[model samples]
Target: MSLFRREDLHSLAAPYALDALEPPERVRFEKHLKGCDRCAAEVRALSEDAVRLAWSAATPAPAALRDRVMAAVRTTPQDPAPQDTARAPARARATQLPPHVWGTQPPPRQRERRRIPLFVPFATATAAAALVVASLFAVQANRTQDELTAERDRSREIAHVLAAPDARASSGRDGRGRTIGVIASATEGSAVVTLGGYGDPSGGRVHQLWLMRPGAQPRSLGLFESDTPLVATGLGTSATSLAVTVEPAGGSPQPTTQPIVQLALKSVGFGE
Candidate 1:
């Protein structure tokens, strides 16, 4: 004689009406419903749709026809329950709850969050390292370029001096006061001298170039053999006159013989 609640109707009547119950459960529900008027009414209401569902499923119709038939049917409205009634103002409920009560606790430790794979930091580090390396290489390449430029300039200066018209003029008096063997193309500098067309000196002694300045002592340039027309030796930059003298096998601080060759350079402004 108890009335069946909508909540309990699904369990008590749905299985029997849908034919999903076992034979024993079906028999038990049928027996209980015989004296139960509330359950019988619930079953009758549900049976109307249950019979229609079974009939439609058993008979297959054309797809277009089925769609037309289904379009004519309307769904039934479901009754709300106690829980549904309370859920009417979910936003209000949320606002009433404390911030801590929700799952809004401070984030987990950094180590735990990093468990998921990511490559942002690693990619950034790689890019930065590449940039640094590129900058370093660029600096080194510039330095090498500067050095090469300087060397090229030095070589060009040497070539220019060698090509000058006055570079080959050499004049001097021998020990006998004879204006002996004229040499041409002589280039002189503070530390070195170069002469052309001067034959080699005889014996073990080598030819040496000296510079006689106004008041300073004669400085020894380097010793040089004269077999080749070209001769290069170290001399002082303060010399006013360029002289070549025969010296001992190595060389001497002073000229041992009268200058076999001499060239007085005209007054010219030389710049460093």
Candidate 2:
């Protein structure tokens, strides 16, 4: 049961989703997945993303490009054989006698320079191509790992908010017909916000969350896109409500439009 720590097994989700794990690692992760719902969910999400990325990146090679390359190969002249440089000329050989026969040091034999094979250039090109591919793969893997790590952190924060001693949940629809759900915790001074049926906003506008108080100006909780959940913290004691408004692309210091939805954070009783 303790063969692999939870964190270690959790880190394998991306590799498992991509089918990049070795046989043993794959076996371990599969065993871990059965008992770990979070890991299983992550693997499923990553797998779907991987498939989309693969399909999007797959471009068919030009049909004529191969024929043109083959045609060029057929017409290209082969390189001439390299001359044998190891042998000395007959005259030079005749001038130098064996050290034993001449009783003198035979002039130092010319150092033989190694000749590079013609296939070496092709090998080098292949190696360069391989390096480029490897670098691209490394960048992609790092990006995926970063995304997964960020998601895990966000989930942890949301979990903390939901588990707060005095947390309360509320849900309502925005002006644009998107569902906004909020779980606010006075004890934890934070809230977890979730958007349902979220998509790209029209009119080049963005949705912004605000922290509201009775007499003070609304404080921005930052702009958001897509359906990703957001965790808002640092509500302090003065904050009384959470509101979402549609604003310009970069967002406004104050809400330019009316709130699509609002969740009251009055003590422990949160309501739409």
Candidate 3:
């Protein structure tokens, strides 16, 4: 019933005991172990196994060494007066405390000597996670830049085609006699259009473009936004007209709502 396999859960015990598992995954496993006796037992056994290895590998000290250390410890006198501690003693300078304890004396210089070895694995994993996040943001930024570049190029191309020698344009009126423009390259079938100030679509609907030949079914081009100049290509050589209609967001195979505007292209020699 769990999302991950039971074997996968069992395999995490060693890493979990060593504090190597990442959080959230580690937290989830801990929660699961509360109910799963088998997994809990396996983690305990693995932890004890590590302790057993430490015990087995330890070397025994000589028998007389303990008595000698005790005698030396007894002869060393303890400091009783705190006010006489202004002098730096040679014995204090020579003493070396284990690294795990906080040193009572200041270091000769203030600086990082080295990183702690225990944190290396976690630090590496955190750095890797940060790098992966940065890469994803970089990719998204690049894609957005590319899209803007392409849009600028497209606007420039539309302007060039409109200014070309062989290009022509036409206009058509809606039921209210308001006009929309269609401009195209007479030879290449490239065109730009205006939506003729049609109102926005209702919810769950969109505006669609079509290429129509006289007395024939319209071919769907794609979707468009209102009142903006639409740039299109691949208009059939026989298409003498174009239309805009409302449809669902994905656009229909055929016009589903009544056309809001129609442009007669024959007069402009579009797709001829």
Judged by whole-model lDDT over C-alpha atoms, candidate 2 comes out at 0.60
Best by lDDT: 2
What TM value does model 1 have? 0.30
Off by over 4 Å in 2: 1-143, 174-177, 270-272
lDDT of 2 by residue, 1-272 (tens): 66778899999888776778888777677656656657665776677687887798887789899999899999886532222232222212222211121222232343322222212333443333222211111111123555655654655566566556677777776543346777778768788776554554799998898989888999999776445567798887778788888898999999988987777776445432
Q: Candidate 3 — what's its lDDT?
A: 0.57
Task: List TM-scores for all candidates, in order.
Answer: 0.30, 0.43, 0.42
lDDT of 1 by residue, 1-272 (tens): 43545445446775655666666555556546544555555565566568788687676568998777677654533221112112222222222222222222222222312211222223443333222211111112123545545423422333333344544333444432223221222334422234333444667878887666677766665564332122233333344666778888888989889987776643321121
Candidate 1 all-Cα RMSD: 47.4
lDDT by residue for model 3 over 1-272, one digit each (tens)? Answer: 66668788878888866556777667667656655656665675566566676698799888799999999988975432111112112112111211111122232332221212212333343333222211111112123545555534544555555655767767775543245666687676777775533545789688899888777888887676533456778776688778888899889999987887777787877544
Error of model 3, residue 118, in angstroms: 56
Q: Cα lDDT of model 1 overall?
A: 0.43
Ranking by TM-score: 2, 3, 1
Name the top TM-score candidate. 2
Show the lowest summed lDDT stretch of 10 residues, model 3: 93-102
